[model samples]
Target: MDRRLPVAVSFMAATIVAVLALPLELQLAVLITTPSAILWMGRTTVQHARAKEDNLRRISEIEQTINEIAGEELLLFQSRHPNRAETVGGRTGMSAVFATTLNSLLMLLVCVALFGGKHGLTAQILYFVFITAIALDLIMGAVQLNRYVYRRPPMILLEK
Candidate 1:
């Protein structure tokens, strides 16, 4: 099981509780900030992915040079580190999907809050559901950011 899944789920739960418990102004702040943060994180993730790819390419080139000089298949970088050599799919699409879903949900809730006046049980329930959705999005964005920012480089790269 991917460890990040559990961490993301727990983070979502905590965010839901925290946001729901916050004052109206703070909740609004969160709603305002989340989209911007998602956009920034998406950009950062792309840049990080590009950098990682470039670094891997450089490592492969260096290994090839070393092998040529030694006149044999000495540094089998890919064979030795298959996991690191494997390419991961881009995450920009996922980020866009999450952002779009969160925005639509937020807009729906805003409409309800603005036009559907009179806070009854149903309205309250809708509000809760929307808040939960927003919290989930926030946690997912955090998870994505964490995945790129904190990943450990391949051990071979660290060997100088």
Candidate 2:
């Protein structure tokens, strides 16, 4: 499965909803799905890491055979390459999240300024949903950032 398919779907859904002026709650829910999925994926990654730790001996043994033929230096290089790539990807992802967070904040402020005075129930509910979704997005981003920044080193087969 394409890793980005969920994000693309979420973006497209949100765009279409906004353009067509769909029901506001549905719009907020659709927009929230992407960050919720991101948080779910992050949780899965953490679980996989824990499982790897539990089976570290088996993993190391399997990797040891490959390292023997490929050489330790090659194994080290291979490990470093993925780590570097992940770091770069994480940095890019964080930047996007930050921009989205700022946009959400601005949107929230505007909604409050424009609709706060009006006591229309639907508008009020929509505002709350929007604020909640934005909060969730920021939270998910922070969790992802924390995991990225403090990530464990890849379990290389051989020690330097």
**TM-score: which candidate is best?**
1
- Highest lDDT among the candidates is held by which one? 1
lDDT of 1 by residue, 1-160 (tens): 1233334334443544465566776765554454344344434444555565456556767788888899999999643565554442224333443444454345435433442333567755765666565546655654553354324346654555
Instruction: Estimate the lDDT of model 2.
Output: 0.48
User: Candidate 1, which ten residues in sequence have the lowest lDDT sum?
Assistant: 1-10
lDDT of 2 by residue, 79-101 (tens): 44343434323444444445444
- Which regions of candidate 1 fall more than 4 Å away from where they truly are? 1-13, 79-160
What lDDT does model 1 reach? 0.50
TM-score of each: 0.44, 0.39
What TM value does model 1 have? 0.44
Off-target runs (Cα >4 Å) in candidate 2 are: 1-69, 75-78, 81-89, 120-133, 148-160
Question: Lowest summed-lDDT stretch of 10 residues in model 2?
Answer: 80-89
